[model samples]
Target: MYLSLLTLNSRSKRALTESSRPYELHRSLLKAFPDAADGGPGRVLFRLDVNEQTGSISTLIQSEKKPLWTRINGYASFVTECKCKEFKPALSLDQIFRFRLRANPTKRMKSTGKREGILNTTEQVEWLRKKGMNNGFEIIDVIALDEGFVKDKLTDTDNTGHNTNMFSVRFDGLLKVTDVDVFYSTLRSGIGSAKGFGFGLLSIAPIKE
Candidate 1:
């Protein structure tokens, strides 16, 4: 059983690339406190340097989006920590890391392949790949099920109400899964910014061979 640790700090050259939609910490600051400015402390947008499970600094704007494991909002959109706790899976048979993954075949909207019921995990994977990442990545399986095993309404109510409409995948083979950073960044991100990114981690339950 082997596990590899990976970290990212944004490409310095890539960071300097031009951007029509510039990222301003003020965006978050403004959103956090709309009336704090023009008088008192003005507005205070906190850019926390959260150390993710992978030891990577939260550089992108997406570092702020929380994971769903806490509230079960549906599929985690960003990189996810490999949480092996809730899974009571019996992997003795094939000792496989089974999950679902979709591919976005285009740059437009539905480019992330056709989803079975709803939500598009395809696009999410593509977004991460485009950012130049390769953390034992693979779409081991793809189950277009008409039913899911979870419940409704994420804590934020941001996903397809029915959990049935989701793509599941696993990372079990020769590697001990660590964390997964999934999100949508349209080939554009500022220097040291999350741009359109999201990430998270997961604990692991290695399948016994």
Candidate 2:
């Protein structure tokens, strides 16, 4: 596993567009690994860092071979820096860590059998509660950050050809790793849905002893 951090040029239009749409960014990330196929289950998890001024991307890419930094044309200039390092995962039972994740909280409607996002704060928290239970972790002092709809240049046909609205909620808290295996899988595969659109990337830091 390799973790890469890329600093992007914010002024570039292509950068702005790609930053807004997770689907496009996924494609952009694949360019780093020439051997990776364009379509299939992805081995990469990415999250954007946006502030008042600039934005950056941090990606956890799983590959046996080192990746080559590939830039998109006309979209933006090449990444300012591609910092990469070999990653080795270490875990222990009942370990606590400071965690952060941008997740798309949603559930299926029992009546219409349709998938809808949970935008309500109480419901979103409940959704996370259930998710944590199933994923073998517990949230301690978690707060949710609302990041409204993420509109893309293209509309989703399944969504009545309307702009696919993704309700992004950022979760920050201290968590105890219960089931080591499940926690690892959650970190790799991500939490809820809309992963392609930048929803489910789990970031964590060891608690200072």
Candidate 3:
């Protein structure tokens, strides 16, 4: 797997425009890997982080293939720095790490067969707990930050004229790996839904004691 960090120049008009539109931003990131197709091998996952106070923008991208960010035209001017590195996590059973996941916390309504965002904070935390159980991790301690809704309009070839509102929540905490194999898969495949629109990328670091 490969991980990339792109620090964008928030002051640039093009950067600001794409940042506001998730679909456009996703398209922009895909320029890094011209040969890769969505939902195919080498699937790309990304998360956009914006510092409201500082007006700074940065994005983290994870993929099965290495990305050549320079392939994108004029992308260098929009970014202050771009870094990509190989990511291979050496995890053991019962190993603990600090983790952050920006996910779309939701549940499907049985009657309507449609998914709805979990609005309550407690329920949001429970959502992550359930995910950890199935994903081969145990949540030792965690908190959910309600990031509200991310509105996106699809202008792409297939989904043109479609609009979507995705509720986003940031989960941060310490978790212990219960199954190394399963945990590694979770890290690569990510967690939750709406992955294409900047949700479900899990970032973690070993805890230093």
Candidate 2 clashes between residue pairs 3 or more apart in a chain or in different chains: none
Candidate 3's residue-wise lDDT over 1-209, tens digit each?
Answer: 99999999987998998788877888888877845345443678899988999999999999888888887768768888999999999999999999999999999999999999999999999899999999999999998898889998887677568789989999999999999999999999999999989999999999998
lDDT of 1 by residue, 11-40 (tens): 322222211112222232233222335232
What is the overall TM-score of model 2 with all chains considered together?
0.84
Clashes of each: 30, 0, 0
Which digits, one per residue and each the tens of the lDDT, describe model 2 over residues 1-209?
Answer: 66777776666676677777768877777666654364443467777766755345434444334566764443237466667787666889889989888888988999999888888988888888889889978877688888887766554656554457777888888888889999888877778887777777787888997
Give per-model CA RMSD.
Answer: 17.4, 3.5, 2.0
TM-score of 1: 0.20
Better of 2 and 3 by lDDT: 3
Candidate order by lDDT, decreasing, is 3, 2, 1
Off by over 4 Å in 3: 36-41, 156-160
Winner on TM-score (1 vs 2): 2
Q: Which lDDT values do the candidates have, in the order given? A: 0.26, 0.73, 0.89
Question: Where is model 3 poorest over a 10-residue stretch in terms of lDDT?
Answer: 34-43
Worst 10 residues of 2 by lDDT: 56-65
